[model samples]
Target: MPAHDLGPTDPAVTVPEITASVPTGPPPAWAVLQRRLFDELDGAWRTFRDRYTEPDGRLRFRGTIDDRDGADDFYEAFFNWPALYRLGGADDLLPAVKLHWEAVTRQLTELGLFHHEFERGYDWFHQGEALLMFYGICAADPADQRFRERAIRFAEQYLPQSPTGNYAPRIKAIRAPHNGSDGPRPGLGPQWDDRFGGEQSTMRPYGLPLHDVPGVAEWNDLADEELAVRMGHHMRDRLGRGDTAVNLAVTALVVNAWLYDHDPRLASWVREYVDAWRERSHAAGAMPDNVGLSGTVGEYHDGRWFGGHYGWTWPHGVHSVGAAALVGAISAGIVEGDADRLDLARRPLDQVWEQRRTGLPSDPEATRRPGWAHTLGPGDGPPVNTLPTRLGLDGWFDHQPAQVAYWTWLWWFGMRQEDRARLEALRDHSGYDWTVVHAFRDKEEAGHEPPWLAYLDGVNPDYPEQALRMALAQVAHRTALMAADEKGADGKRTHETGADDGLDLHKWQRLNPVVTEVLTQLTTGAPQTLYNGGLPLARVRYDDLDAARPGLPPDVAALVEHLDANGTTVELVNLGSSRTRRLRLLAGGFGEHLITTVHWNAAGGAYPGDSRDHHLPAGDEVARSAPVQDNTIHLTLPPGRRIRIRLDMRLNARQFAHHTSPTTSRRP
Candidate 1:
């Protein structure tokens, strides 16, 4: 086939660079926090490489490999590798990355694609992740067009066929393939033991490679706006319409739209899909881990099926984060046009925050409360309550790994200030650990920790020191992965995974490592009280008050400056001590700014609704002024305080000076 007809080569495409000239104006607080996260991510990548890579660039896995394909091991590594590249630039680890990539690629080819239990293999989700990893490398290095071109071609050829026709009927199996094929097939690889019942238990079908393959087509179609629209519509109809599939599918489409600089249509699809999914996912009083619009609650129903079930589940973290990130990207893409995407992005994040605040476990871990299940599988079997199995951590219980990646990505990519704050809060509450811990129990007794934390150990048995070593090793692998390839003809590699790809991997590694450690520590008699229910509070103290002067802009400044000076601020001081006073600070002026601190005197010792009471202890305060053009300010009162304040703001005459009146003023 002619080269042009083959689609853009990897080197020809340029992964969008983090422009030195980021969006200007007072940077959002999330952006600032993201820098900190990026630094940490970079450090982690360095640690990983230093520990894992041999002098010659070969990578080793320390985790267990139950199946011949080593699909679990590969996936764990794949997830971590992308994160290191996305958050931390891959300036140092080029050769090692290339070597590892070559190995993995050769392995995939030799294995005739990544067929695990059922038809599960890299050809599904992991392939997309690999493409993303390779694409990112191409973006950073841009030295190899071959990689980029190959990725694009892969997308063009595979995406359309994967989700439609014969692929459509196999959607469920594609997602969570656990049962291995009975006979040898030509294109299909070896069969692996069934673990999670394959695709039967999985929720999101598009999460696998099937969802991301369209990214290449969308990017290539960008120049032809009409074609882009048609493609976007087709994506919406096929992938976006499925509740379980829509989130990731819409996310990929939105990213394509942003890369191509399209209008609101793509973003609208994301918003609608997410909104519909959210409604369907919410139960009478609880939000399920994963649920389709048709009200089908799969294996993730209680969230604890994976492991200890403590933090986030696949649907909550993976699906929710993907949806939110896409919304955020679209919001940024349309900042010059519509504000709806911003609102959509904020909604799910707000739900996460609210759920965190309520002290409810984001996963099924809480449902198993007091008692925990350690093993991986459905909860239908007799509950085995024992030492190793009883120990639960965020990674074992929740989708903390993926959630962290999603949260960090949004922070780095510049999400709305409030949304970022909420994500930060979730991260803080996540109880993450960076080191690995050893597992003393047998494979069955080890429970869900192994597979749940696979990204960290990678086929190695859970030895405390070894787990830590593997955890750190992932950072290096990730860094190297980022440095290997270059952009092809398109700005991004046609076959590369989008930003979301890296995010999923990073989150899984970080969370799993911590979870492994936490579970280990728990087995070693770590205090159970350590699992605090509340989210981490970013502090914003209102101290050094120049007196409670009434003229102060009944705004956060009054609270902030006061906190800075005096160490605390009183939103409402005189509410009757007997009834438990409540104070309300109009947060309208606060805009997207975060509130990290509010210290008021509580007469009832922090009773609910009492200004003096700190029901939700304040940890950090992040606040942002409304866009100057919006003529608004944000207000935050102490947690339980009550004070009447206006949500509206008045713009000074000078604010409008830049705009010319369409018609001359009649008075003039």
Candidate 2:
């Protein structure tokens, strides 16, 4: 309660007067680019909406994805639309987002892929992707009863002793890897298609889930029907039922629900589930990628824990496991307010680092080498550090530079000297220039953390301009891609229907031109929220007082220049030629952080030198201190005026929620 102790009701604290610094020069390049990005995103959203959806915001596809599971793909396409809306995209975006979610849920339910507006049964990897849109919807409009109901409903399906049977309270783990409203699915083999029982062709790229299926030693051998059947049976028996590490992502969904109402059960579930995995990781000497129905580390794979569905062996390896661990760890930390919960993610990261190999591989050009395809810097640079990416029966393999995402999230959450030290060490050893901005986009639509971190550390002064330019380039590229899509009767691209090749599955993300990564990092003093499933956590957020909505006001741009243990320095620039703007700055994405004081510089004689209140005159400039009420500070910006605000902040000092004034009672 001390975080909010300097309440307005307290007579001792004085309300500070704020004045903007009127500058007489051309607007900064970053400010112009920020407004341009928003404008570009506005046009891009219109094109996407008109091209893909019907009048009611439903996609124009005629049927479900045949022979393959793709409910997640449909949702992921527009998952970040609500995030754009929250970022001041357009007023129409919020309603359109809701419409798309409703239409997609209805369509998926009709396809038998959903029950109770949630995934029927699917791996958490895909489910996490699917739920991103849902989470965005909730965050954008927490006051909506529909989203509130769905949040609690969707999370309850994962609770211990729930009728869904997705979890077992006795084991303190999810009952199976593939689970949701319809409970754990019975088999891994496809139920929708008769040919091959599932499209083996779609999965052929990953080779066999289990290659040693009696007479099947190579991927080509699986072409024989009998061998393929044997392989399917092997997968069904071993991976059809069990708790895999990727299920840890479900903690975010539960935590999302808790943020709405602060339900004890939801928070309790996150703590128990993450702690259960932590105990298992400790016992196994590393985070085991799989745990069986009986809570055994390797109940189904002949006492081997690395080969389960979406686990450590077949496909993505530690990429999947590490991301899940990080999600779970962060979610637990949110509910428990314990930074130590990060150890759930840290232990595996450290273990992987321990297996790291320095210098170049003997066969540097070999595609099959351990450190083949990872981004370790320029091709002609010094040898970068490499860590194991996948753990198989053969031991550590698929080496690459330590993933920046894991280290970025860890540092953001931990915010400790050791975390900073580790992050800096990784950056130094990454073989990449931390100051260069690359236009490459990953699955999360983010891969520029190196430059962003450098900017935060003051090593990359031009990062804001470079990153924003790159973001603009990304928008332009995706716009061209959208233009190239097959046009429909309406002259817009038509949605591909009933195809299982998955070429068109990612059409949304590929063509989605809304790039918020730069804006979020530069303005809110936070990295892009974990793309798969992460609650928005930031040092600061803004609401447009004039428009009465979240995000920066129109024609206004903000940049957080520096962040430290107890404060953040930001500059708010008004780009409009006229019409003063009013904005409210909130400390934290959901009003979780506490703002102890606000320091701003005013022109000469802006305040009286004899004032006994917070405003004090210091030579030419007047320095002011403001008492923040309910985690908010109001600013009025006149045209052509730019103000630098230095906010003293207490990070994560209170319970988080969507509204500035949260009524939900938290258990802490």
lDDT of 2 at 111: 77
> Looking at model 1, which ten-residue stretch has the lowest summed lDDT?
527-536
TM-scores, each model vs. reference: 0.35, 0.89
User: Model 2 misses residue 216 by how many Å?
Assistant: 3.4
Best by lDDT: 2
What are the C-alpha RMSDs, in order, of all predicted structures?
20.9, 5.5
Which residue segments of model 2 deviate by more than 4 Å?
A: 1-17, 22-24, 191-207, 359-382, 486-503, 605-620, 627-630, 660-668
Q: Which stretch of 10 consecutive residues in model 2 shows the poorest summed lDDT?
A: 1-10
Predictions in order: lDDT:
0.29, 0.75
Model 1, range 1-668, lDDT digits (tens) per residue?
Answer: 00111111123322211101111123323223323333445465454444443444333332333333444333334332422332223334444456666665544434444432122332222222233344334432333455544433332221223332111222321122111122211121222111111232222221211112243332333335454444344333322222232223323323232222223444444344444434433442333233322344433233321210111332233333344334433333222222333443443444444433223222343323212222222233332211111112232222212233334334322324655565445534543322233322211112223232322223323333343343344334545444432333455531222232341222323222112222221111111110101000111111111221111212121111111111222222121223221112211111122222332221322223356764454332223122222211122233223332112222111111101101111110
